[model samples]
Target chain A: MAPQGQVTSVPDDGLTTRQRRNRPLVIVHTGEMKGKSTAAFGLALRGWNQGWPIGVFQFVKSARWKVGEENALRALGEVHERTGQGAPVDWFKMGSGWSWTQRGPLDDHAAAAAEGWERIKADLAAQTYGLLVLDEFTYVIEWGWVDVEDVVATLAARPGFQHVVITGRRAHPRLVAAADLVVEMTKVKHPMDAGQKGQRGIEW
Target chain B: MAPQGQVTSVPDDGLTTRQRRNRPLVIVHTGEMKGKSTAAFGLALRGWNQGWPIGVFQFVKSARWKVGEENALRALGEVHERTGQGAPVDWFKMGSGWSWTQRGPLDDHAAAAAEGWERIKADLAAQTYGLLVLDEFTYVIEWGWVDVEDVVATLAARPGFQHVVITGRRAHPRLVAAADLVVEMTKVKHPMDAGQKGQRGIEW
Candidate 1:
């Protein structure tokens, strides 16, 4: 019941509009020792270039000197430099160097580390970051240092504006299910089995 | 103290020897929107060629026809054709069809269309994939259909050998905390806001 040239359309019920505005939660699961950290660093660099505040966390308890982590942090620093944001110090590096827990009980050490992690988490939550990487966060849960439920509850309650990333080997299944997206990494080949040590800058 | 020249020599500890056996997880979080889905597709394609099993999941309740998913599935089909590994019908034309919660009371029609997500999740956790992608999963949570905790738990419990990726905007902090890498997509300049309708094969 309209003119020949009239374009008939449905009324604008706010449904579609609301859906369009709803943002989602994204989670990437990179498997163990598969350069997931490096890829994460690349994403962080991209986010920083766009002027987003960023934070990085490591949860592995092994306390070994990881070249990959070092390199990722270094790259982030360089990205910041290029963007004229004064170099962001590598807090992990500056902190008490990796403390290998190969000996006796790690009760005290883990407790202290958990405190540090909480502080970092607080800073991350307070800032308006576009991207925040919790490298090896699964280890915190895996090691039973932090309560997984508490972590999940806190994250779920956050504002929709911030993005966070948790990474580590043996991530909790609950964490994966709760995420908006999940990715796993598999390894098919490597050069280290050939009796070669990790090359300085390249491997790191 | 022993003689300087005869000092007990330390073993290499085999850290380097075992390096080859360790496969690191490589996760690439491009962002929530924009080109992330395509970037993930490219990475999955590369991994699939190496004989890696790739899992794809779309969390957005509403399924719009997407050429990217179609093209990626086609590429996968080609791989199956060459490898004689019967093409997985699920790979090609994969999607959930429509938002899980589209206003109005839950109708039988909508419930019927929402079942595909479960199948997709099952495939991801089946342990057959080298890389798994959960696309637009953020919407699932945003729409309040899937419990974020369940998703996170499932993903975390996945075997250590698989690489996983979750993509969408406004990801939960818990998922980010559990992820090895997280990338947030900030909309700097998008053509859609300029009154450009999505183009087939390009925007999809």
Candidate 2:
């Protein structure tokens, strides 16, 4: 309700205003509503505008599923490459495929999810992306594929200025507690409530 | 929570599934949290991927305020113009001045807000864009600069397949009632709570 970028309270974290303000954020988007992943992608767009390298990791969504954000952002990445305007972008889906694994597509969701977390751990350590979006990652935590404590610890101690945004429903309490910004997307109304199927371009 | 594009129920509105699914939506993002405008901009990116023209109208934010979304989207617009990959994008900020008004930056806030609403009304009636983003528009209604009834009625009567998304906090009840998809962004945590100022690349 306050204007954008207004701080309400200040904690005694032994850091200066500049240090606190410039600290890389861990943002979590959770709840049983829409716009969780969409908003995460939106944040990636902002990061892209800032010439930040972006990495999108989809956990629940299938690799075959082509969302509009992928196309647009990929195109933006291409634009960045061509004109040297923005930064690079990388998108990886952890449903059937793991980019690091030699296997083509895994049948085991749990194994795929675990491997995905391992890759994320390596990326966090390397500080591969300025903005890393873990789309639908909460499900893996809720499903117990990845340890919440590990995630919290890894994110808390991530190297460099990497901003991590995790999105999905039923986010673990520990993850929420560790996050710098947590947004719960509550459904007030939805077309599906009226039995309407998802529309093209709107839903995808 | 359901997979993207999966419908939970079927309505008996006498329309086929395709027709029902393809219906344009009025999405409202409200509540006292971040990512409302961010999510709307994400939707606009999706619309742009579908080759739908996007028009962004910023109501409360000043023209001097240079958000990152504007830069990325405008670049995408240029990409569309050159390669014809995506649709065109137009951004209007109604704070210091109105595009239609010949007069320079107005000193009056109420008059500026009123004129901004008038321009949106005209655009809605004309069906100028496929996706119209009314960014931070809820404040106009809450401030009594624009009538909520007029807004709902105008949006309800909008012709063609235009999808309108309004983003802001404390949305009027009637506006929510008229919206097809309403997302209330509830804040669980924020960096600002710890007295952190907004960061570059992340906040802008």
Q: What is the C-alpha lDDT profile of model 2 across B15-105, one tens digit per residue?
A: 6677666998999999999889889988988999999999998898563353788888998899899999989999888865866778888
Q: Kindly provide the TM-score of model 2 when superposed on the true structure, using C-alpha atoms.
A: 0.90
For candidate 1 chain B, which ten residues in a row score worst on lDDT? Answer: B86-95
Ten-residue stretch with the least lDDT total in model 1 chain A? A93-102
> Can you write out model 1's per-residue Cα lDDT over A75-130, one digit (the tens) per residue?
44543554454235242421343233334444565675576567655655675455
lDDT of each: 0.51, 0.87
- The residue-by-residue lDDT of candidate 2 on A73-123, one tens digit each, is 898899899999888989888765866678788888998999999999999
Shift in Å, residue A75, candidate 2: 1.1
Candidate 1 regions exceeding 4 Å error are A1-26, A61-107, B1-204
Error of 2 at A109 (Å): 1.6
> Which parts of model 2 are misplaced by more than 4 Å?
A1-17, A63-66, B1-17, B63-66
Kindly report which residue pairs in candidate 2 clash with one another: none
